[model samples]
Target: MNIIELFEELKIDKNNILLASPEDIIRIEKQINVEKRINPDIDVNVANNLILALKDYRQELYFIASNRILYTLFSKKNYSRHHFPPLQREYDAEKIQSFINQFLNDDLVLYFDQNLSQNKFDMINDIFDFKNCFPEDALFQLNKKLNIKLDSVLVNLSQNNSENNSAISYVEYRSFYVLLSYFSSIEMDDKIRSLVNIVSERYNANKLSDFYTTCISSMQGYVAFDPGLTSILVRNREAAVSNSIERSSSGSSSGMSGKSIFFIVIAVLKVLFLFAKCSSH
Candidate 1:
């Protein structure tokens, strides 16, 4: 079936397409591929629209799928059970890794195409949103897979526009740091850390430090922050103090000690001063 015909078959309005389940998505892809194979002269616009829609639907589906997998692996109740039986734990870990790997591989192909666009970048951002929710080990594996894909994209983009002097945009820079933060959130192997250091050095050192700190602050209550990476990034005494102050203020408020309250007050004052400085500039 063609794009329009497929939508007709699905009985969904093209303008208000709801999320499709994985099974329905796979079937739609198959139908579209078959149609293209049978009719090489299919309208380009229709094909492109269908492909873009498919990407949107797939992103939602993948996000839900990844969240479910992570919940199964890292729920509080499973934590103790995952550790007690050594062999079974190993087996389960392998299974979980394999499942996650399949999802990542499929997602990479779906989202990262030869013609990179804003949509692809948005897909990466969405993936990171859910990927960060995973525990350290799983997050590490996901980060590795994602970084490999992103590196390939960067290489292709560079080769394709060798003479272009345009710098990465603000949104791209923000997304890049999100990926970096996730990668650094887990304990890294020597090789991975070396690779990350190289990537980190590509950006302005001070800007990178600020970006990393901002990322940590934004994700504060959502996921566990890795102090290991933060310590390495925020080396200046003043920035380190500011980060500690913010962290203390943003943390749970129950049963606060006098020192904690004092830090919160200082943090608020510092924030106000920073805002005034920016406004003045």
Candidate 2:
């Protein structure tokens, strides 16, 4: 059954459907025909089935649209890129609150409120907080906003188990790489190093080797470098060596020579450089 027929049978006004914009409605109409191709029998209860399917599709679209709106607002408030256009003047807090009241159900609002607390807007968790209304939807929106490809890895990582639920997921790793690329492009390697430090401490996963290997293997052909990522990596390694030296001095003397530390840092930096270069290629 077509979407129009299903809507008519369900007594739903196509224009007044909750949480759907005009473009979404048009896409829904097109998608219904596509869905019908999978079950073209058109049985006696076909309209009911179609209505159910369309409702599910509409809900999915609603989550996607809502995620995009929220992320856009968050980016505007936090990142505030000078090159990007300003958000619509109509999207102030009062206007957004009114829209939220009119459009979203209470359950969704509460979910968003709970998740918003977890978003520091400085790390991957800000984009993929599972406590959110729909974390998968939010991840998709973040990828769209950043123009990156990370959905497959994100899905896999979401299904895996981690200690303290704080293990670094593929989404987190890829986002860290992307952030490095972005900051490097803008000559902001310090920001990249700071963010990496924050994520490393927050997640506390002792799997840097695994993370590096997996990131390189998965993103080799799909990733691109910003020429600043190399600089970020070098600086990060230097900072790591400096911190190691400080800790060693403060604690027990392990007799680790300066030359040994220099070589170790170089080796680590070279590996990171290779990873970044391979991903970009």
Candidate 3:
């Protein structure tokens, strides 16, 4: 398997690794080192970068994932309607907002590291600098109340798919499809793999295009989101809250609880922190 494929395989178990025990972390490291030793040609740098893009920066990754998923779902719809998918369906922007809020909360450990003032407007703006997949003039009402500017580079759901369509494919963004599939998960929505393929076929970047096409071909085969993801995240959040409350009520050692939650949070957030450690001018 190529680097992208191998990283894809590793990405599948991100959340599992995120919540692993201390000994499990050690075992995982050993297994990974063993695999690298067995495969001399494996691009360890790319594999490590893929992990940074997919698993690290929990808040940032989810923010990007939600935007990209929303762009995919709502871009083609009538921006004036604001009904999300089907007009007759019950979905709407309010539900979307709720999902973002619930899913983006800290893993119940940020409060310890620092204060949680929760004003992410600046961070949101910075992320959009790298990518904003929303359609032009999309979510007009939603964007008006929210202080955010969104101009789409690619993936314009506003336009129908065709030769003239500039939506969803670009050389600079070629790497994103590979990362998105892993972030959303293959089992969640199989459409991701197809979307990755579509982007792969758009060889508009000249010489750079050939390099990316090869990368995409090597990375083929993967997948999702919908109301299903929203529901799943909501349930997970509720359960986490209930568990936290129970532990607190049980009079468990605060030291143990803090250590456990802190460990998971650091494990998940570490790579992204290192990835962006070198600030760009």
Candidate 4:
């Protein structure tokens, strides 16, 4: 199939298209390279797949980021009080998603892809094991899991882009910090501290400091999700991080507690695989 036809089959539309033209693709990629320059270890394999899954993975973040942010805004600018104000073509679908793509690509998206490859996923293995035969295996893992879940709700803040034109909402990040807490240590805390500092500075969001302080103060460790949920590119799960959000159709959220966080983690896992499935195709 030609590129245009392939994109159409992928259900590409004006709203989701970051690459409106060949030039757009090149410009987006240059943005990815800047991150690699800063952190050489970061694998930007997502860019390789961006061309492939323009509609695939987004790395899976767009759905989560967009749902939290724009759902209410896009629900209707038609309202007056307590509603999004009149948009001046600044908040259209393409620009909004594009903004998310650019913001995530910088340091957040690949950061997630790189981190997931870390040993943290072993915890998810514990969770996914479900261990029907040994239900405790998954049940065995809830303590650390739930703590990190608390951290996620408290720490994560999602906005579609840097322009500050999109909506910002509390979204769930990747649930790997439980691993740091489970195996608490100087190195883990230090690594996350560096990341949090960078993320906080880039986004100019203070919630991250909550994570940074908590994470370093003790082995409490913070919960941060995959920003690549709104990022571009694809990395081979095997070669990059072993693998890798919510809201696009997360349906709705109720009370958030350790119990709720537990369900959220599983939900995130389902979403991750959903993206993985898209990548496979």
Off by over 4 Å in 3: 1-4, 47-281
Candidate 2 vs candidate 3, TM-score winner: 2
How would you encode candidate 4's per-residue C-alpha lDDT over 202-239 as one tens digit per residue? 32223223332232222222432332321111111111
Cα lDDT listed for each candidate: 0.40, 0.39, 0.34, 0.34
User: Least accurate stretch of 10 residues (summed lDDT) in model 3?
Assistant: 107-116
Q: Which candidate is the best by lDDT?
A: 1
How many clashes in candidate 2? 0
| Top candidate, metric TM-score | 1
lDDT of 1 by residue, 56-162 (tens): 54433233222433322222122233322222111233433443443333333333342134424444555443443333554445556656644553553335342
Question: lDDT at 232 for candidate 3?
Answer: 29
Preferred candidate (lDDT higher): 1 or 4: 1
Candidate 2 — what's its lDDT?
Answer: 0.39
lDDT per residue for candidate 2 within 1-281, as digits (tens), equals: 33333443333433244555667656755654665566564333544444443454554322322343343433222323452334333323433343333333343334334443343224444443322333344334443433322233333344544442343353334444543232233223332333333333322233233453334332222222443445444443444445456556767444345664464455445545554655575
- How well does candidate 4 match the true structure in TM-score terms? 0.21
Clashing pairs in 3: 75-157, 155-167, 155-168, 189-224
